[model samples]
Target: MSSIKEKLSKPFASLVAKRIEKWARNPEKTQQKVFRNLINSATDTSFGKDHNFKKISTYEEFKSNVPIRDYEDLRPYVERVVNGEDNVLWKGKPLYFAKTSGTTSGAKYIPITKESMPTHVKAARNAILMYIHETGNTQFVDGKMIFLQGSPILEENNGIKLGRLSGIVAHYVPKYLQKNRMPSFETNCIEDWETKVEAIIDETLREDMTIISGIPSWVQMYFEKLIERTDKKVGEIFKNFSLFIFGGVNYEPYRAKFENLIGRKVDSIELYPASEGFFAFQDKQDEKGMLLQLKSGIFYEFVEADKFYDENPERITIKDVKLEVNYVMIISSTAGLWAYNIGDTVQFTSLKPYRVIVSGRIKHFISAFGEHVIGKEVEQAFNEATENTSITVNEFTVAPQINPNNGLPYHEWFIEFENLPENEAKFIKDLDNSLQQQNSYYYDLIAGKVLQPLKLTKIKKDGFQNYMKSIGKLGGQNKIPRLSNDRKIADKLYELQLTK
Candidate 1:
């Protein structure tokens, strides 16, 4: 009976893959179908009678009619549904709520519906497949897969319930397949972050793991713990590990340090995952990324950042979406969310359906001193500065501060250098010049006599991790805020900035 069920499900999975591949190549058409399906599903689940949300009928209509609803708008709806209101936007009882620490806002509890589970699983699967295909490891299924995920126990109703998403997925993953897996959530160490790290370390040491998955910072911290616990180098222990799959945060900042620790150039796969939906994954091993499965039970919408607030907002259909254009992602899923603005920015690399990249977040931009700097701009500046200078920065953070002497604002950069140069002044000037050339607003602010001069501070090794730990958010989804815009937050970050 079990074998029969497996056989029946196998064909559906294959069909999903084929359709995804096709939709990836022609996203516009797939999006149209997805949108129609979303409206139908949402109507069926919420209203009980089929009704057209006029604003969302066409891509342009969706943009014009449905206002971009942020986390705040959805919070009330989530609360209502959780309180046992029938005929809510979401049909089923939320399996779990994924907890994400908000940057400007406080903590966010995103509802995870059963219909949304397939999206996460498929995206993860696609990412793994892409890594294997890229590395020519077709027999990846033969080895044990290790996942460093969140705690699986949720404190609820004066007792403990299995963690919603993590616990639910743990329950569903096939027993035969899961028998060969090692997960951080499977252990009894669920109370403290340190305990979890120690448990993960102990498990990794015991297993002959091939593929390792987690956020880069935590993984690096774990490697550091391993080094401290034993005389064995990270490279030696991770030598047998073939693939390193990472997501949730930027890895570019810590690239070189991570490579040095691993001993060899590590093969990595990036994923764009969230509680709302798994969204996209790196599909082809060689190419940067491919949109894996946008049509798998969820409908996607993109609003032009410039016109998101317009009276008649303009929305880009999957066909209308262009390459290299940054768009705010809106999703309508089986979870009953309608034109939900997720606050994420994405750029398409190709016209084909699945050729898109998760650029960054809308709110992550830094205009601390009115320079309007963003993650891509900062990354470009770092690349340009490093190209001409001898200093190699492993990780960095930029905070805008008021110069007490001049009563003007200036950018204070905290950088971890790989090799220190004798002429520190010259290196700082080069880096400043790179930023000035790359960012027009920054250049004008610095050279055009708008703000105080740019300052560079050299930080000690593992300084960022230590600083992040100080905030009680050391591992997992926590990251060094690339740009500090808030005055109070910037003040705190300014104090953490290391000099010399």
Candidate 2:
């Protein structure tokens, strides 16, 4: 039966691939349609009327009327919806509120309208379908798949279901995969992530688990658990497991460690999903970035990352985006988030197909002395330094040491090493040099004596895990920042550092 179903999926995948390629090639026209549709759909809503959505016919008009807003900015309209008001942002009350933990605000409730929810399910499905079409390897469809995520259980608030985005997505998995998916509903519903993972191990331990998807850190724990039980690499246990899907954080820093855990390199898909909307996904195995979903209900606007805080900085659409330029992605979507700043910074790697690599977060970076070092640069630098070497990284983060005890202030890297480097001094030098090469400001800072070479503090094994546990964020979607402007994370990490 699985074989028959697998055969059917290929043709369906091909059709979807062709459809995706159609919009991908006509990016400008595609976005314009989404833009018009969004404006038309919400023109009757409170936000639309207040923002002059009826009079907005052109991008310039829309841009002029709507100011870019973050979660807090949209909270007024969202609060109305949360309090059971209908048509507050969208056409009517949303189907769900993707409840996410906010930095300042206690909990952020991003509305998931009936019109917007399908896109989340479709984008994830399409990501895998496109993979099948491009790779011509759909055999994994016959095997059990697992997406390590939050509980499928949801809470009701004012007639709307509310939960983490992953949890919300869990309820929508296709019926065909009900039998093919791993970790039974009971196990998945376990609230404690550590306990849930253990339950998953007990359930999936001798099963044909062929597809494993999750955040890398949490998945690492699962892999470690499996290894502990059987003393075997993940690949050896799940002989047919091929596809690894992940999002939320870059996978490069964890690549070496994963390779060690799995015993071999396997194919993986990267997705750009948020509580706001499902944005992009890896459509090709060889591509440098995920293909931006232009034809999706979300209309995208890009603001130059460095100029994001400037007085009325230009917000350009997809047509104006250039290669390698870091952009803060803005969206007016069916989810009724108008000019919403998703906070992710991305760099376009391919213009023709609109492929983008998530570079960093807008609020996440190190600019202590004006050397604005980003997450991508640091990850690249570390990956470059450790490439083909024995030093495997478990987890890592960067922050500025503004007032060091010694010579000069420098960037401090907190890394949990799976295997310590053979020559620690050279590793540090290579890592610092690579960062300098990637970010010109960092290079100038070193040359101008503004900052010393970056310093590395080796964290004890499972130190990052312990830190997360201490904060009650040990698992499920909580990612360590790659770089921070402040020492909040650095100070905490220092407390977890291995004694020299």
Residue 394 in model 1: lDDT = 55
Q: Judging by lDDT against the true structure, name the best candidate.
A: 2
Report RMSD (Å) for each prediction in the order shown. Answer: 4.5, 1.1
Off by over 4 Å in 2: none
User: 40-155, model 1: which lDDT tens digit per residue?
Assistant: 55554443232345334666655554555787876777666656654566664665666677665776767666677677776776666545444545434545667666655564
lDDT (CA) for every model shown? 0.66, 0.90
The residue-level lDDT of candidate 2 at 370 comes to 88
Clashes of each: 6, 0
Error of 2 at 331 (Å): 0.6
Candidate 1 runs further than 4 Å off = 1-19, 44-57, 60-65, 103-106, 155-172, 184-189, 290-292, 306-313, 387-394, 417-423, 487-490, 493-497
Q: Weakest 10 consecutive residues, lDDT, candidate 2?
A: 491-500
